[model samples]
Target: MKSKMLTVLFMFFTMYSGFSQDFQGKATYESKTQVNMDFGNRQIPEDRKKEIMERMKKANEKTYELVFNAKESLYEEDEKLEQPGGNSGRGRGFRAMGSAGGDLYKNIEDGRYLIKNELFGKIFLIEDDLEKLDWKLESDTKQIGKYTAYKAVAVKTVKRPNMQALFRRRNTDGKDGEGTKEKKVEEFIEKEVEIVAWYTPEIPINQGPADYWGLPGLILAVSDDVTTIVCSKITLNPKEKIEIKAPKKGKKVTQAEYDEISREKMKEMRENFRGGRGGGRGGARF
Candidate 1:
């Protein structure tokens, strides 16, 4: 048994060594996100609701590509051109469409990652240590296209805005104190989500979409409850050289810093909408 184990280790090292010399690939992926919107108690016409849902669907559908080698990778959403004289016709519901964050560049050897985020018409470059999820390996196996894949699962905690809490109003009775008559707005709250990934040992590279990596093999599919990104096409060891470099534009910040910035901006926007002239004269009064 010890001799067999040694043989396995030898083969693993041999394969990884070959990767350093001649291993590069490009992968195309399709990303889909589920949209859920609540219009509160406002009685909206059925026609308007249908129009909102359609626009939300279009914004959620996206395509991306990942170019990678043994040491690094670059993943970016493919830019889609708008049709001539086309109007996006986005509304408040459009925000429910969600975003994939932005372009990501990872250097596995250096344990580094850089992400470009566009929030509130501002660009931020987040540079930080690569996010390493504590993935639990499963014995399950499946065939995805021509590759045999294995399963892994991870739990991640993210801070999300409490949208409902933003609209909370305090009761103003005849006898009311300061604390009893005002609503406390919660800017953000923490939520946990599960990530399931399928990877193939055939590629022998530790890489995946977005901030997902640290696996023993190449990830072909990754899904959370609301979003899923699946590999549609993969080209390994192409004849032409591929470049895997970091994104170099935007104001630099850390992941935590960027998250704070995003939250503040979102809160400001919400407050503005609640008080603007277009928001019905004296904002929304409950």
Candidate 2:
């Protein structure tokens, strides 16, 4: 059955090659992340805890759109108006858990990517080579909408922000000096995680929602350890052609440089929290 599917996909791609120039697709994706908030030994009212969870959930749920053709694709969030007394204010710290700021443009033909990311108040244009994932195709199949999707898995090593360190309270045991506090920098640690993607050959573009690509078909759904991004809607060959262009604004930097800058900024924030400059009582806010 796998061989049959591949054969049919090859034939379909060959037939669609002539119309590739005019074939463009717009896919809307709904992205959500599961967050486990631990307040350590601090005792909190149940009502306040529930409120915090609600705010975090609202902050983590997001909508994105991907515009793609044969060679290049652009993915960015679809902004929405915040509700009254929403999580917009306290959601800054949780920004690292979701998709990065600005537009992500991938050129599959050239194996390059350009991402526009904003950190604190600085805008950075991250230009780097596209990360090629070693995907292992599986024989499992499932139905996503009106398409028959196949399963593919890939293991990726990513730098995840240490949430425990961010909320850890300073030790004020007064071991060395009177009224002294132990300061620890919040850092990102590297870990290996498995990525599962569902693709359908009906849309033969090697594009996915975020930085995921190089699949045999268009990826409809993808999930990692804490987040899941799924395509909710797809529009093919719309009346108006969307211009797929790379963002030119912001200071140019590589991915590594951007990460280093983020680490330094996080450290600064941690220090500020320790110095009683952050939220009330519990060192850092959610």
The CA lDDT of each predicted structure is: 0.71, 0.76
Q: Which candidate is the best by TM-score?
A: 2
Tens digit per residue, CA lDDT, model 1, 68-91: 988899998887777688643221
Which segments of model 2 are wrong by more than 4 Å? Answer: 1-5, 8-12, 15-18, 41-46, 87-99, 173-186, 279-286
Model 1: lDDT equals 0.71
How do the residues 215-238 of candidate 2 rate in per-residue lDDT, one tens digit apiece? 878999999998899988999999
